[model samples]
Target: MANVVVLLLSSYTSRLATSVLLFISVAHTQNTVVFQPSFLTATGPKTAALLLGNTSDISLYLRTVSPSSETGSIGPPSCVAEVTQWVLTREQVGKSAVRVRLSLDKNLRLCGQNETDADCCPKPLCVLETLQVSACVGGTPQASLLIQATIHALLVPSTAGSDNKTVIPNQVYQTLGSCPCDLTFGACDVRCCCDKDCSTETLKLFASHCLLGPFGGQVSPAPDYQCSVQSAEDSSDWFPFLCVQSPPENNPYLGLFYQGKTIATKRGPSFQRPILSAPLPDNVYLQGSPIFTVNDRYFTIPQKVLGRCVTNAPVAFLKNFEVECVTLLHSCPAGAPLQTLPKDLTVKVKNGQGGDAEVDVIEEVATDLSRFISSTDAVASSDERLACENVTLALDYKFYWKGNSITRISVTRTVGTISLNVALTTRYSAVFLNGEFAGEPNSGNPGYQVGLPVIAGIVDMLENDTGSIQRTSINLWKPVGDGFCSTAEKKPVLFGENSTSGCLLPVSGQNLTQCDLLRETVTSLQAALITATYVAKSGNPDYLTMTDWVNISYVTLNSSTSMDNNTSSCYGIPSHQHIHVWSLITSTVDGIPQRDIRAVQVSYSPSTWALDCGGGDVSSCVDPMETQLFPITSSVTFTDIPINTGPPKTRFQINFTEYDCNRNDVCWPELAFPITKYYTGEPYSQSLAKGLILVFFFVTASILGTPWRQIRQAWSCAAL
Candidate 1:
């Protein structure tokens, strides 16, 4: 399984409003303080607000506490509010007052569940309430303030017509009875679950658990999506498949498109509905009759604990039965498409059982393959191999239909358990293969070979074998555990084993059969791609550039590769890099050169393979070449000795060319390419010539400094 990295994002809201400060005083420089705007009028056009900011680097959070009930019952005393993320340093907000919006959604979830009550939300009571805002910096609350507000009730349709005589509206708690569905539009929550006209049982179920409440939005009337599911003022009616389903691990909250119509379900009270009535997402295909939903005996929704705190945010752990499906037998009404045993599928059956025979067959794989793939705990030598069973299972419902009547007799499938074993071969294979051992140089059919250190050689060759059997050609089913089932990218691969090394699965689930060696090696390459950044100083700009030094070897840049010199390419601040043609194929057929095969080989003999470490008799180190070549490949290439040029030069330096004005329009700053350099300046021959000339001048000056004594005497006589 690939190690997945997940990032979570949090959101907070702020509003701009005028300041309304009450008579209050506090010490300056204190970490805790409150902003202005204290009271809110529900009936007034302008709303009350409290704004906070100005803590330069500290993260500020304001947690709200509702007033106690003794104070004329603070409206919605159970209501609470908080700011999840307020990092004051990043975004600049001046001292001006900024309103902090105080509101909660209809979930009425005080915490994470949906336990509702009068105090669960801010009831529009227009009562004097104390809204206390506590300011915290760096998670420590330094101060708190009480903001007094006169709240007015917002008349919502759900409570607008409630009987005031009975504080608890009977309409708020009513029973839901069976009613016809909005066949054209699908289902209507208001007509059924929240229907004020419904029975007490129905409304109680709706209020307590039904997720379907109301839908209010502009509807585009069209032939395809024309849904006239009755407006709020219309007559009371019920709809099928409108109630909520709560399977322990199955969150039926996510709705789906059923048949042609979309029957969306929510997390609501079951109201004694059958589990088979729950709709599965589109991914799950049912081969049996639609009437199979009537089989309540087998597909029943189990009772679960309730009063779960709900929220608008998706419940990450909320179990979804979206793709879970089961096939059951049912007789369809006449005029149905002829039902016959699915030819593409099969079923296990018990035959010749006198009257009628029925059998069920299924295939289930391991729930979590990673559990069996590896163990950090040491196992006894005898218990090296492990098998995780029931990772995948297939159950088919095969029905034979004569006319409209259907008959499902048999269906069976087996899940083959994948068994993985770890064994220490202790130098199981040789790394070296000379011409003789490889059976003649250039002897194989349309063949190619790369020379490398024994370890690299094995990898490059095994890579070929892995390619020979295309990994993509073989389809691997996504495993069950340690992964998301919806997408393959999120699903766990290779049985949840993060690393495949020292792991081996039995070939075709057979104990005697060993897995393909090449496959095992290939599968182990699941670690993250390692990235390295290299920088090298230039010796001579004209002839030098950085090279890749990995595995203690310098991978040279191709001769034709040139370092970039376009400064304008990066906003007049140019960057450069070294690149080369990297390939691994020797040659091709039909007079074509195969993919370029680039290889570096390090070789040595450990035992009897070659001279055997000064060759005496015979000894071996995993065929001798392995352990010997391994160290050489990893230790030899780093050279303190400079890459020599034709001859030594007097002076040189890596130079950077500036961008001319003409390039400004064509530039875009993208990658921060490394500043690469190559050799530069005068040739060694020119410097040597200049040095010789200087030497000749120095000799001439020395000779001229004192003329020969005879020459001096002759000059004196001539003068006389």
Candidate 2:
């Protein structure tokens, strides 16, 4: 009996292996059926009808192929297959014969027992392995087509290392759901009525206030003239006669004809270059190419555009530029990193083989940290908050390059103490030098040019050594559009343009204190104006002379009290100042004009009201506390003057003769000066000859008048 059982088991195993091999062979031999024009028009006997066989065989095949173990009895198939049909119509060529084409739809339905409810059967119980499609003419079958179904299943491993694992089968179908706009998970969004997190009580607060009237705040569709119609106010009178009748599944292009063949179009090249995210070991640098650091990141610098600060602006190779931005520094220790410049720079240089090679250069940045609090110190250590007011924040970078590659770099940073909510100007400038010695830029060629900033410097006269003077660039008041008479930024004055800017000076305190502070502030502002200054004789500093400076003359009202009210006269404050700049244009012998600022005059005008006590004493004035605005204006004028080509001559001596031009009989005193021509010949002889001719014409005109006519009349009478 044991021998017989062993032989039987061996035979069963062999049959099972043969069946598995047969299934694989059938799957491979089945060709993919692709519908095409040739397949329908080929010369062959046409099929009249197509039908699918019973699906019970497919369920039995799946059960035979499934694995079983000794731990459990053989179970029914997990899925049962259902048939899907597709019908097609075909026409025979050059004949009045109607043919039928048939194909098995790839999608199949499966039904199975539900795990949650033993009695319930859910869809997708079994996967289809193979199906038979029969071609029949009337009731008799002519031929049959075998179709192997492709099964897609997701296998999930059993956690207990057992055979009890799940396989999820997927099918192709259309699905519908509500629009998803509430992206946030736990929290209820404001004005988002569709958010599930919004409870009934919370939704009631903003249900009607939704931005898009609920519906997940989705945008509404635009009005369509063909599909949308205006409804009448009274529903009883509304009619659909003029409304468009469209079906739910209407095709927009139905019944339209398409003629021309489709020609594929290729896109044009893009102007933007790809930014490098990783550093290149050795690469050539090009203009406007993104710069990279040694680390795998693009090099970025802080920049500002349209009054907004951008911290991640990528640095471009071989591009020299500057930017000014306003930033708020809250605390000293927190803003220390911003005050330091970038120290590591990755540059490209020319190699021995004439190719560009990239190298990393680390330089020490000049940093000033005395103004900021140390990171180790506590914020409450100081009594007063350390705030940098009206301080300059500058970042300067100098690059040394050979040909198109940079060889070296230098960076400098000058920052002030960080403050809370303070708007500070951050300036960045870059200079590229081909060689060590680079000359400074001039404002113009030979003289000051219009639209260019004026070159002005403060002159400090040495008291002991009167002949020596020290000159340094001075900052002038520049309007920053904050407010009238408010804090301003210092900038150089531009030539040839007239500008008026003012700032508010606060005068708040007791009577005496307000008066003193107001006077002091006015004095300081007036003193800060560029008065006695040294300027370059020409735009180019190479031609500067010792006497290149000019003193500013102040024009004031002829009053006993000074403009600053120094004598306590209680006079009105000089709140308005106008500076008049005069440029002298000297013409050379060749007629080339040379311009230089020869005179600068400033005038002061008092305000309408005086800040003084009723007794005319400014020291005791305490009427009100207010802020005063002081306006300063500057204008430029150009004068043309001839250059003295010859040696200096004495002034022309003239004898004055008193004559009354009011009397008709008396002739006015001869007041004429000789014209000194620069390029023309003498004109005295021509003038005298013309005067003699004019005298002769005058006498002829007199003779031709009354006296000559009377003499002729008397002679005629004596002859008669």
lDDT by residue for model 1 (1-720), tens: 222212111112222234433443323343434444333332221233334333443333434446456884434212234542211212323442233444433222232235446443354443443445444555555434344444344443543564658344222222121132322344344435433355675566545344332221111111211122322212233321242333322422222222345456566678966567544332121222122222211221111124221111121111211122221112221221111223422322212121222433343343543433332334434443454333222232333432232234334432334433421110001111122221111212333222211111111224345311101110122323332212222121111122211111111112112223322322222111111122111111111112211121234324353323221111111011112212333434422333321322222211111122345533332242222210100112211222243555334212311232224443223121121112124433345456678779988877676665567788999999
Task: lDDT for model 2, please.
Answer: 0.46
> How accurate locally, in lDDT, is each candidate?
0.29, 0.46
In model 2, the number of clashes is 12
Best lDDT among the predictions, by candidate number = 2
TM-score of each: 0.17, 0.36
Residue 648's C-alpha lDDT in candidate 1? 50
Off by over 4 Å in 2: 1-324, 327-344, 348-395, 399-408, 413-427, 430-440, 458-476, 484-486, 509-517, 547-549, 554-572, 587-594, 608-720
- Shift of residue 708 alpha carbon in model 1, Å: 99
State how far residue 146 of model 1 sits from its true place (Å): 9.1
> Lowest summed-lDDT stretch of 10 residues in model 1?
423-432
